[model samples]
Target: MTKKNANTQALHALGQSLWVDNITRQMLDDGTLQRYIDELAITGLTSNPTIFEHAIGKSTAYDAQIAELSRAGKSGEALFFELAITDLRRAADLFKPIHAATEGVDGWASLEASPLLVDDAEGTIAAAAQLHRAAARDNIYIKIPGTAAGVKAIEASIFAGVPVNVTLLFSREQYLAAAEAYLRGIERRIAAGLDPKVESVASLFVSRWDVAVKDKLPKDRAKEKGNRLGIAIAQRCYRAYRELLAAPRWQKLAAAGAHPQRLLWASTGTKDPDAPDTLYVQALAAPDTVDTLPDKTLEAFADHGSVGAVMAPDGGDAEAVIAEHGALGIDDTALAAQLQQEGGDSFKKSWEALLKGIADKAERAGNAASKAGLA
Candidate 1:
């Protein structure tokens, strides 16, 4: 037989979970998502405002449902989330098997809280719980930004037994902050004699770092530049992740039936045309971690990607790479903060656009319903 999903299967065999960072009703209804799960070993899916905005705005797959919900008087953020929960619930059901098989380690779908709530700790906590309950699936994670307020929300959500995917973290310190929030939540649950098994993941964006610094590097050093910053940051984060799991704090939680909050690699798609399509996927391959890639990146990897040496637990050359960039006037800390803020703002813009698109679509849908004597 020909090599089918050869590279994806190879990566899966190497102990890393590959999740597609996109979702749509068409993919689920047409079985494309299922095929990815069965053939390409895609164990999970993730969604953000940007992804949902495109999936709903760019296609008619959601038209009928939008019309139905519009008739039922749902619009704005409520309408957007109604559509999102529908799609994610379907995806979560598809991944239910892997979720059960791995005992909640591998298969999971993520739905982000509204980007507007990034700075509202109390609102974020309420939103996460409500969304998780709205999704009503064990495999669904309510995504919260890993901002300071979001850290508070993360802890509160987890303590309330809602799974979370902490997004927008760009540095090792940021990742640690998210992880600490998760630990505190679990620790509280343990203290309260709760289940203490709330699942979570800290998402560290990668490609954006390289994209931010690519033009800053010297022209002659262009070829050696794109992959350095992102990979270095990821390596450092990965090292901390490994160390955190090995620490006594985590061991106590483990003994009390807690699971490690996985370190997720987000924004793995190569932003540079000159870079390898599988660059981040190949470089960040490590066990006990998750890599959420865009559909194109996943397809490119499935078609021709290869899994090479796994990332070293000791964070090989991460310090050196950061030092090199520091010498070049690139403050990794400052850049990390900038990237996190920019990511939040970009998603907010997308969320607003998506809501507008939904309003417009709902109006058109209502017009058609009136014309057809169905109003």
Candidate 2:
């Protein structure tokens, strides 16, 4: 419906996987999510606090469910999970056959713990395990932030044999840290006489990098603005990902049947109207990497997304391009830190807003019940 001979046709033909980056209860129940899966070649899906917050606050879709949960004394974070897991589990079920068909290499959905717990190592791990348990499905990957605390949680959770999607990574260093945590966790599991083969992914967010450096990228060219920063960063990270997998440590891990957590490209929507909506989708195509794109981006890509040259595993010009920005007094590390902090803060804001909205709904529902009883 979006486009004939869609970009996904080329992407799937080339062996790269495309994943839809958003989900909703309506999407699941109405077969919209499944239709995307069938027509769009979408093998996976991802969700976060902001996504859940919006899906809950902006629609009557979740109201009846929320009302019932409130009656059972569920509120706040617990209430939110009840809603999200139910939706994700259904989506995961739809993807289950694809997952099995691919031998666990594809067809997965992600659920992140509270963004408020990003800096809380203990809290993140606890929430991750709790959500994983509550979901009770194998195709679901519990999402943990790739913050300092989250790195610790990633290692621990993986060791505990929980599949994880490491989210919020903004740079190569951050991605490497998350990878190392996975290594340590798998190594520990090996030492404990347990299977070290933990399924995981490092989600490298794109577009935000451009948003972080909108003015810094060489505006000397028309295409040099908007999403270029994120693409360059992702190109660079893909190079690192190639190198790390070829290293001896990872070779040993791979030899032991551990699935290397693939690097996923996230936040791929083009924010600038001047740029092609499918900018991120076209540039970051590589085998074994996942592109979790927003719906608009997906539609744009499906319409006109042509097969571009696959990203070089060697990371062509990424460091130098990033260095050009770094030379402009843009502290790359500081920017990563700032972005992460902002991301966490935004999640917290959404979480609180969702809680307040839920509270209001519960109050109104209570009043209606009271009126009905009195009548």
How do all models score by TM-score? 0.98, 0.95
Name the runs in model 2 displaced over 4 angstroms: 1-6, 216-226
Off by over 4 Å in 1: 1-4
Q: After superposition, how far is residue 282 of candidate 2 from its true place, in Å?
A: 0.4
- Candidate RMSDs in Å, in order, are 1.4, 2.2
Model 2 lDDT per residue over 157-239, tens place: 99888899999889899999999999999999988989876799999988887777776655674354345567888988999
Locate the minimum summed-lDDT window of 10 residues in model 2.
217-226
Mind giving the per-residue lDDT tens digits that candidate 1 earns over 196-256?
Answer: 8888989999999988998888888767665789999999999999999999999999998
- Candidate that scores best on lDDT: 1
